[model samples]
Target chain A: MRLSYPANVKIILVPCTGKVDVMHLLQAIQRGADGVYCVGCLEGTCHYNQGNLRCRERVERVREILQEIGLEPDRVRMYNLSSGEAPTFVAYAREMTELIRRLGPNPLKHSKPSIRLEEAA
Target chain B: MIVAKRKPFEEILQMIAGHRKVLIAGCGTCVAVCLAGGEKEVAVLAAEIDMARRLKNQPIELGQTTLERQCDREYLAQLDDRAASYEAIVSLACGVGIQFLAERFPTIPVYPGVDTCGLAVNQDVGWYEERCRSCGRCVLDRTGGICPVTLCAKGLYNGPCGGTNRGFCEIDPEQPCAWYAIYERLKGQGRLERIRAITPVQEWRDTVPRTLLQPGYRKPEKAKS
Candidate 1:
């Protein structure tokens, strides 16, 4: 019998988390991400005084843009994890994987059904 | 500085739907100082548009350029060599600059990316509020520096509205009641008594029908022998 491994998800890593620009976040959603989140240092402990805070603002703006485009804002998220928190990383992946399982494919994919105005209305 | 904000991404996408080549023009003037339509914004907008086009499988070429001053002929002339190459030009300048580009490049269509918000004062980073309407009148001497016509929300020239609560405007809780600010300024300068007299209704006709004039020029006359 052949052994099989569970499907894995990809998480983009950034420096200080604040470096993640709003355009990058919007592009990720536009390019079709199952679930996206920014993992940074704890609120006050950010290497940069407020890099995490900046990332939080960008995430909020991205959420607004998603809502404007009729997409679910909940699909995007933000979180923080310290370097030693390997378990926390695993938990995040698990949580995202489960959410992805329920969410299915990304709405931005051309293969998926397009958003209809009348139906949405 | 002339503060402005870009239209929504979808709105911009719709504006240049069928155009293949887009020239993103940025003005290094009031728009730049306000962090609105500067060079950085031009590049970001171009990238976003390009990404949107590629995502939809409709690839388009976007050329980005910034002018020292879009309203001046010297800055606009810098694009003479390459201006005709693009199908459309997206101007990230004030309304005046956008029209200037259109006049200089009559063959190409120019689309305004930013909505001319209003004359504003930057409170701080990422915070700006409209401060003046520039109704072509100057009455600040009597009313103190605070502009009652613009900042008051209701444009009341006399004093705070009845709805004012604890120095904030009723219209927007975040905004300071313009008339109240004016009153305080007058009190500080001992000009409170001077402003007690009501100001008359301003001639609003000057604010209507926008007009543009070329600098240092006069209409040519049709001469006869």
Candidate 2:
């Protein structure tokens, strides 16, 4: 199977997407990621049973946390696809990249210094 | 265990808005088990607050720490030196822990990060149900270990009210009638006779603000040499 997606997107593989935690997504945004999304095994087909479902829940939770903190919840998403469906995976990557491109860079990226200064004051 | 849930993020933002530096103190005991105010929750909250402050251009200095048990003086003592550095402290412990911190650090303001919900037992992963009202009485032996004070909406002592429909409570169809449950449980144990016994009016005095002093530990009468 051959497929191509945007080069800008980076992937971090986890043993199981269920292992993805709320903090992991928050940290990604804190570290300047304009957008983040999780690609998990298709719903109900997760090798570890509910791992994909758990990932989906975590993604939604992170989205809520983002909204609470004044960020657009659309910056993050969750997509499900089986291992054999490379085309769908590529499509999701392109879709996420397009979404992020529209959202622009994360607001917290350049404000690190100002935040620290205000904190100290 | 005492269960709680985090306050809405917007309310918390409003609370610490005036302070530039704030410390989020988490408890590693009950709140942690409930997934509300544990170490992981503290980190997530810290990051979210930092981002919110940054977004508002009102940047705040955030610090995070978790004590083994916020209810204990020994664990709270760990925050002594650092507590002074921050303008305010956001305690992620239950109501008790928050008050203790406020009393110990009279100079610093302590805000509650979580609302202490109630005494509950985990029904399933991420699910909890209240199990005890701390009514200052012991009736479990007669009630087949089910607590009517906590489970029954009316806190009926002798039996359920007429509001019971089948086995479900009238207040909510989803909830099983506590007295019905007690009846079934006792009947199964060949103890239905207990239900017929009239329970005396509960003494309300014991339910008031009360303290228990362990009788075993009295200061050893000044040891005479």
Candidate 3:
């Protein structure tokens, strides 16, 4: 299983993708992550039953929240893959990296000047 | 529980627009259970609003607090002095809590952050279905614990209306007709005869803004004897 994906793509493993709360994705974005994506077991094939399904719902909800706040909803996503599908995982990583590259850095990271001025005022 | 939903983000922003500082008051009881105005939701909303405002160059001074039960005067009193610092308060409580806050804080303008839906039962995670309308009359005994007032689209007491087709509601094909459910439940309990007993016209007087003085509390004038 020696697969080469984007070196810049960092991964944070979770017990189950269902354990991925909305706050986790949001905090990642707030902490200057250009993009965040959850890779869970394939739909209906979750080890803890509907863990992947629940993660999908949470991703959609976070997407909606992002859209409401004028952020690029595409910056976050949920992907399904089984343990054997290493190729698919690499493909998803590449796809997400490309999407984020096109979208540029998260606006929050660049908007510090106005925020600093606001605090100073 | 009294279910509620957050008002649209845009609408909420509009409410506190001109104000530079505001407090988000969350209710920890019913609205929390409904996932609308709990402590976690308050934090999420605060972060969202803060981010949105910062993006627009109109950063707001936002504070957050959650009351054990917003409807109770004692719980609301906790914010007595602290709430004075903010220009306005955005209450993430049900309608009752919003009104209660206004009453308790006569000088402060308290805005509603959530819309009180109705009495609801959790259908599943993130899904709630209205179960009762609090119509002031209990008909669960006759309806076999199925509430037609809230479940039926038309709120018909003597029902299984003409719109019912093969036990499904005409309004939504996916939903079972409330009266059909009532009939099945009664049949299962061997209480089908209860449905036949003509229910009198519901007293509309009780439906108005009514208050019940708890028996142990101050007795009403009529009950003074």
Among the numbered candidates, top lDDT falls to: 2
Best by DockQ: 2
lDDT of 1 by residue, A59-121 (tens): 897777666555667677787888777778677767767776787766566532221111100
Error of 1 at A95 (Å): 5.8
Tens digits of per-residue lDDT for model 3, A1-121: 8999998899898999989998789767765688999999989888899888988998999899889989999999989888999999999999999999999998777543211111100
DockQ of candidate 1 is: 0.07
- TM-score per model (chain B): 0.88, 0.94, 0.94
Pairs with backbone N, CA or C atoms under 3 Å apart (clashes), candidate 3: none
In order of TM-score, best first, we have 2, 3, 1
Task: Give per-residue CA lDDT, model 3, range B107-172, as digits (tens).
Answer: 889999999999999998779989999988888999999998899999988988899989999998
Clashing pairs in 2: none
Any runs in candidate 1 off by more than 4 Å, and if so which? A1-15, A23-37, A62-77, A90-121, B159-175, B197-200, B208-225
TM-scores of all models?
A: 0.75, 0.93, 0.85
Q: What is the C-alpha RMSD of each candidate to the true structure, in Å?
A: 7.8, 4.1, 5.0
Model 3, C-alpha of A29: deviation from truth (Å): 1.9
Q: What does candidate 1's lDDT look like per residue over B90-160, in tens digits?
A: 89999989998999999999999999888988899867888788786767878887788887878887777
Reference A-B contact fraction recovered by candidate 1: 0.02
lDDT for each residue of candidate 2 in A1-121, tens digit (9 for 90 to 100): 7678999999898999999988889888987889989988878788899998998999999999888888999998999888888888889999999999888889888866222211111
Tell me the whole-model lDDT of each prediction, alpha carbons only.
0.77, 0.87, 0.86
In order of DockQ, best first, we have: 2, 3, 1
